[model samples]
Target: MNEESRTNIGTPVPDASNPEEVREQVERTRDELGRTVEALAAKADVKAQAKEKTAAAKEQASEKAALMADQLRAKAEQATQLVKDKTPDPVLEKTAQAAAHVRETATRAGQYAAERAPDPLLENAGKAASFARANRNQLLAGGALLAAFLLVRRGRGRR
Candidate 1:
């Protein structure tokens, strides 16, 4: 046997009389095919890993958005609740009652003054007129003070 034939013992001899060489060729082809399959599997695994990471990131972003929306909704609800709490039916009713009382008192005082000073030229006419003017000023000052007090009270109550 020559050197080439010795070195090519387990490979295909390319001669029809070599059954062992043909079997070795078949085994070598199987090993090469297995290696190719392993390489393809590694590429597939990398692609699958990339897809999983993308899916995870998308899921996390969606969760974060949902959480933010929920927080905003909760804040809005709290603000609405605060507004509702600050506005009361009783306070409005009291303010209206106070205004009505002031109007009724002023009207009654005007009528009393008119009845007491029926004649413009009667005795003590000047004094009565001066008293009426002073009374009106007092009523106006009292009304202004009361209104300011109510406004301050209402503002504080809201806070």
Candidate 2:
């Protein structure tokens, strides 16, 4: 490697015969160098790259968790259906009777309480019961979700 050749490795060598051509070449070289520096700086930014990777990983994990929850819900529904299908007709009838009895007992208890409780407390309890009746489906779904979460946590603890 001769000294001149080594020194001129990257430096632009424009035509000295035309000042205009030399100026254009220098401008082109400067633009190219600016682009190169920007690319190198992006590559060297470790924090930015790590942040990008973390965001992608978090998105992927969220998607996977959602998919898993959907699968678990489907499986639980299937299990419930299977159990219902396998239960005897007489057992189902007996269960329904027991549920009816429980409802009757609860109603009797509520009436007794309403007779003895303060008017304001009774009014509040009536409102709460009305709300419970109005939002039964939502309340049941929330309770089921809480139960499922507890069951899963318990199962993990056992493991």
Best by lDDT: 2
Residue lDDT tens for model 1, 56-114: 99999999999999998788666555544564556545655786796799778767866
On TM-score, the leading prediction is 2
Screening candidate 2 with a backbone cut-off below 3 angstroms (N, C-alpha, C), the clashing residue pairs are none
- For model 2 the local lDDT of residue 58 reads 100
- Residue runs of model 1 more than 4 Å from their true location after superposition: 1-44, 88-159
* Residue pairs clashing, model 1: none
- In candidate 2, position 22 carries an lDDT of 85
Could you tally the backbone clashes for each prediction? 0, 0
Error of 1 at 104 (Å): 33
Tens digits of per-residue lDDT, candidate 2, 38-149, equal: 9999999999999999999999999999999999878866766655566556555655565568669979999999889999999999899999888654554454445455
- Model 2 sits at a Cα RMSD from the real structure of 9.1
